[model samples]
Target: MVLDAYASSNPDQVHEDVLQKSRDACYKARDAFYSCLEKESGKKPTEIASVGLLYPKECSLSRTEFVKSCRSSWGPETRGGILEKPYTFSSSSSKFVLLISDVSGGDLFMLEFMHMMTKLRPFVHSFLKEASKMFVLYIYTMGDRPYSRQMAKLLDPKGEYFGERIISRDDGTVRHQKSLDVVLGQEKAVLILDDTENAWPSHKDNLIVIERYHFFASSCKQFDHRFQSLSLLKSDESEPDGALATVLKVLKQTHSLFFEDGGEDLSGRDVRSLLKQVRKEILKGCKVVFSRVFPTKSQAEDHPLWRVAEGLGATCATEVDESVTHVVAVDVGTEKVRWAIREKKFVVHRGWIDAASYLWKKQPEENFGLEQLKKQGTDEKSDDVNI
Candidate 1:
């Protein structure tokens, strides 16, 4: 009330021309960025502008301007991901603004969320068919409403997949990050498949990180990766072994474990607990050998990565043998790496194992190939160091 009276007493302070103009510019930038979000709800989020600010690849240009124009006084409300002030979007259909009449009653929220991945990913129908058997599927994303609904049609032309269970940015009650509260299912039974990990900080345990598909060159440059995208290179993950397939395997396992007893009483099962075992099986039954990855003075078994590989259910061996399925190394000329390459086994960089650990799923070995070198390996004994 004091501030209101002060503003009335001092109209000059409240009507400052420069401050009002700056705020107008900020609001315009915010609206444009958000409009882009509304239009490209089908795209996966790849461009991470900051710690919690991740948006679809198509919103890159507008996001930069939004940040640049609004870096001044906008507070991070953790709701709309805005930086300056209370972000208010009035729907053209109903201008009924949600001015909180009661804060203690857990005030209603008009959370800005969009069901991203609005389109059916490659092989999505099959995955959904299998997933629908064990889990209720929901398409929760950071996208606009009209585009989101349009993409939903593209993803589910016959309305068989998500039905009316689509959750868009406009459907959310929280801001900045996405939450499972928007979902009707309990947190224990819900599993999320998203590429951006931090977008849902409150529910990392339920998240299953999926490999991003950058089908365009413009998408690759936004992430600033040193290498070109698979699409630009005239290749992509094989359909049978791509992320959708890999995650399908994980989901099926989770389903099996959740109902392993066959008693049908699901009150005792928690997917979060079963995920640990499922993740361990990512590299199961594989024997791995490492070379030139650890210091000469350190024990190979004592290295951190050795533990990571072991934790992923891969048996670590120092020697190249018939049993070794993978050779993890930094240098392509290493004895073990060369042996694995010659024997048609997987020769992968340390990042391959690290990726598996971080992603909770085995990454493609092709993406983690060791950097090729010009020198030929010095002649060593036959690959069969021991049986």
Candidate 2:
């Protein structure tokens, strides 16, 4: 009764200095209360930043801890385990469920290992072995010739997939740019999987943008991405449904679609169109709106992010309405964000759009919540900053 009275009488409800919690307990409460706020905001983390909440002040500590922890509890493994079936294409903000509020300190290593493996995303041996069948594979990188050859040896030890097909920076025609001109394959039939889009400015139609695998502080700093490299983490993506596995499936489809006979010569068929058709399946029917993601003077349609979203087949509108399925924003304080929360619409950061575009599938919106993204999207004008 005294504690309750003190809590009620306290003028500053925003602070949790009155209570001290364990590492696990603090994070757990934070997750629970955020989970609660999400429920209050209509069961989606993207729904509201933190509207009027029923949570006590102590949970606020989790937000502070969150900056330090930052989704250790929200790994894809936590999202897996029968709660979600494979190929489940649901909204991450609202419908997603967590099996545990916070992983115990003892299991932190295992969770981190899983997340590390997922993010590390090494060149899959099986994927390469199989991929060699459908298409002629090559390793064209910005890395120096010696480093490129060494990495290629590590990837294709037998020299089966890319035997002498490797091209490095020294062999390129342009400076600080990657071009398909160095590649002998026909542009229409070739498909490129690269981490950086600017590396292939003229061949985006032929490019499949894969998420970068940052393993070093040097790479992170070079990219200006604030997140720690996966090299710092402990180990694994689930083998069955991880990025490599998913990409292989997509590759198979692309190959099938390209060779799909229509009693016409395959010479004129463009794999780029087929690749775009497959990529568009990710956010095909969704309508997205932007909130402070674009510069005030720039046309939203002209923004690279807008083009990426539209390329994924989502309709982008400046204003929100019933048809708006998502409002992509970096600022949680924006009016559009507020309207999205009240309307129970999915409110996510711009990374969600890019993630969908990169993975060629819809990423969990909860993972890219505005609050979650503010750390990365501090400079909203840096939309070109790949997550």
Candidate 3:
């Protein structure tokens, strides 16, 4: 049997959907494995045991399509049960085992920290199939909460696999600490699985030492690096080194600069509030400027902050040539608007510029703050903008 680890994006913010997708992926993988086995053994899979997990709201597997699929695959299986509750299995019968987990945010971080072991599934399944005394556990981690009761409803009605539990935030350093301990102790061979980086370490003493296993922790890093690199377009001939181009260039180099998970995107609702604040500041005789990090050209064109500037009756310039280093040329009727990204810093030209045509009215000097004012404020309501 071939044991493997797979990772994919969570569907939107719905925790249930995320769990479902992960489980579906596992089944598909299992089916493929079975088909391969047929080619090798020249016989269909006689028996199988499986465990599936869900994250966030640990809803039990009800009599849903997901649970039904497991039942159909393994055949007239035993009825479902709850997490942390243990059940016994026949070690004499042939068995196949599957495990599922749902991970999010820092809870995921803890899992990644452990050097994960792979190939335990096939080994455990084969072992159970050969021995009459077999025990299989399906565990789920609900991120920071304990949703074991809900998850129990999602379990297989058949009693082929036993014991289900939810890993809570306070259970240990990791959300699913007890589950890890049980898997390590009960199963002679074990495989640690997850899609996120930084899975926390649980009871170090209880960890199972599987001599033969594979680790796959580079999953998240590869996706994250690719996301950061291709986020913007500086290759456009019409606006190379322009506002969008410069912003992209800077952001691509700064891997740590990420949109807060769930933070409003710079080009979305947050932009509106920021722009409104800018206008309010300008009206109070203060100069304000806006800048952004765009991972793509389309995003740059649709930036909300830019829209806010237009709504404020402020003249806006975009796709400026590389020779130009200013983002906006503004006028509060006192200090002209001048902003740009230069040498990886926000360069606001302090020189007076004609409000109507972005033409410099006077030379910029170091003491420009003496006559200019800067104000900072935040929106009371958060917007749906994310990086």
TM-score of each: 0.52, 0.64, 0.21
lDDT of 2: 0.60
Candidate with the greatest TM-score versus the true structure: 2
Candidate 3 C-alpha error for residue 266, in Å:
58
**Best to worst by lDDT, what's the order?**
2, 1, 3
Where model 2 places Cα greater than 4 Å from the true spot, the runs are 1-123, 236-238, 262-264, 374-387
Q: How far is 158's C-alpha from truth in model 1 (Å)?
A: 2.0
lDDT of every model, 2 decimals? 0.58, 0.60, 0.31
TM-score of 2: 0.64
Model 2 lDDT tens row, 193-219: 776778777887877766655544455
**lDDT by residue for model 3 (262-335), tens:** 33221222222332333333213222343332233445447655543343344444444344333432222212
Give me the runs in candidate 1 sitting further than 4 Å from their true place. Answer: 1-120, 284-311, 314-347, 354-369, 372-387
**Which of the two candidates, 1 or 2, achieves a greater lDDT against the reference?**
2
